[model samples]
Target: MTGNRFVTQALGEYTLAGLANCSAEIVKTARPVNLNLFSIKWPVTALVSIAHRISGVLLFLAMPLLLYLFELSLSSEAGFRRAGAMLASPMPRLVGWLLAVALLYHLIAGCRHLLMDMGFGETWRGGKAGARTVIAISVLGAILAGILLW
Candidate 1:
């Protein structure tokens, strides 16, 4: 049989062929739709998961700036002084603090994920508690990072 005829004959053999046609409409109505992000009340576990993803993006975006600074500092004596001065500025210090905090949070969240993979904190209650602990540790780390950065 030709490809189209074969497909048609196979589809004619099952109820799923009819379902395939209406699948889009069925999916649209079968699931709960919430497009407004602000209107939803997010749980701690969800928030932490989102934050973990965002921190990963932030870290990826920061790589170029960090690499440039590293290259500049190693180029020459003058370049090293320039890099140091740039870091000493308020904006660079703030960026450094943010980077540090993001790193700390990402690290803690990653550890949580690793533990979950190992079958720890896989339950709803345990996951929530783990998320809260991650946030608490991140906050404390952020404060310490700010203190040390400035």
Candidate 2:
């Protein structure tokens, strides 16, 4: 009923639960828990999530450089040759390779996140394994990209 105190209190508690980053135990006991994201004791799942965020940011930052290169390569024969020469340099090659690695990592991590949303890797063990798998695939893809780039 609109005048029910218990219903209002329950709704408030649920809203607070959704807002806080506390664990289930903290929620059940209604106690505040101090969490440090930079702690060394973070699990693989946390590491994977952090890496995913980092890679996404890296990709965002690289977009401008990629677009500039694309424009240079498409403008004219001289512009295309200049773009090729720039890419042939060591520093540009390294940066391109790193961006490629970031893309691969982001893509694989995205797939993992999608699977997680579909109810896969929802358990503790599954989450850990999925993190490891994502890391492994990213490393392999980066190495392969490096080889191909050079």
Best by TM-score: 1
Cα TM-score of candidate 2: 0.73
> In each prediction, how many residue pairs overlap at the backbone (N, C-alpha, C within less than 3 A)?
0, 0
TM-score of 1: 0.74
Q: Write the per-residue lDDT of candidate 2 for residues 1-150, one digit (tens) a residue.
A: 111333344445545656577777867786435433343245577678778889899999888998999999999999999998987889999998888888888899899889988999877778789989999998899889988888
Model 2 residue 102 CA deviation (Å) reads 0.6
lDDT for model 1, on a 0 to 1 scale? 0.80
Q: What's every prediction's RMSD, in angstroms?
A: 11.6, 9.8
Model 2 clash number: 0
For model 1 the local lDDT of residue 85 reads 88
Best by lDDT: 1
